[model samples]
Target: GAGVSQSPSNKVTEKGKDVELRCDPISGHTALYWYRQRLGQGLEFLIYFQGNSAPDKSGLPSDRFSAERTGESVSTLTIQRTQQEDSAVYLCASSEWTGRNQPQHFGDGTRLSIL
Candidate 1:
């Protein structure tokens, strides 16, 4: 893909249901990130994956939220036992990551609605 692509632009589910959001980043991009945006707030960092070493998940809200990346291509964000408070737009971004100020490409985001 030429840019980051996210699937299921809108997701609606019961409060306790689980949801899986997917992100396919631009080819060759080594850094991928996930963030959450509530009704009217800034993007909240969730997790970051850089290459094969390990993932930085310090920003994740709770144990119910998790993310994973496959090499440098695709990433998946999973929310377990979703709560009403989890309703928000989940954003995904990718950067080439050669160090020195690289602009990240963003996906439209998945709008999750926990009813």
Candidate 2:
């Protein structure tokens, strides 16, 4: 894909259900990020991966949230024991390895709803 690609564009699950969101970044993009946006709120950074270095998960909200990336290819965000507050748009973005100011290419995002 020319841009970031996310799966299950929309997902609806029970409150306690577990959900997984996937992201496939553009080829050659070594930097990837995951974020959550609540209604009328700004994007909340969740995790970041770059090259072979350890992923920076400092922004993960809780132990229930986790992410993994296979090299610089695909990434997955998993949420366990989902809560109603988890309803939001989960966005994925990727950028060339430049600097923090590098422009990011984002996906349409996965709309997750915990009912």
Using TM-score as the measure, which candidate wins?
Answer: 2
Q: State the lDDT of candidate 1 residue by residue for 19-62, as single tens digits.
A: 99999998989999999999989999999988886898999999
TM per candidate comes to 0.96, 0.97
lDDT, model 1 = 0.93
In model 1, which range of ten residues has the least summed lDDT? Answer: 96-105
- Could you tell me the lDDT of residue 92 within candidate 1? 97
Q: Candidate 2: how many backbone clashes? A: 0
Residue lDDT tens for model 2, 19-100? 9999999999999999999999999999999999998999999999999999989999999999999999999999997387
How does residue 6 of candidate 1 score in lDDT?
99
Evaluated against the true structure, the overall lDDT of model 2 is: 0.94
Clashes of each: 0, 0
Q: What is the C-alpha lDDT of each candidate?
A: 0.93, 0.94
lDDT of 1 at 105: 84
| TM-score, cand. 1 vs. native | 0.96
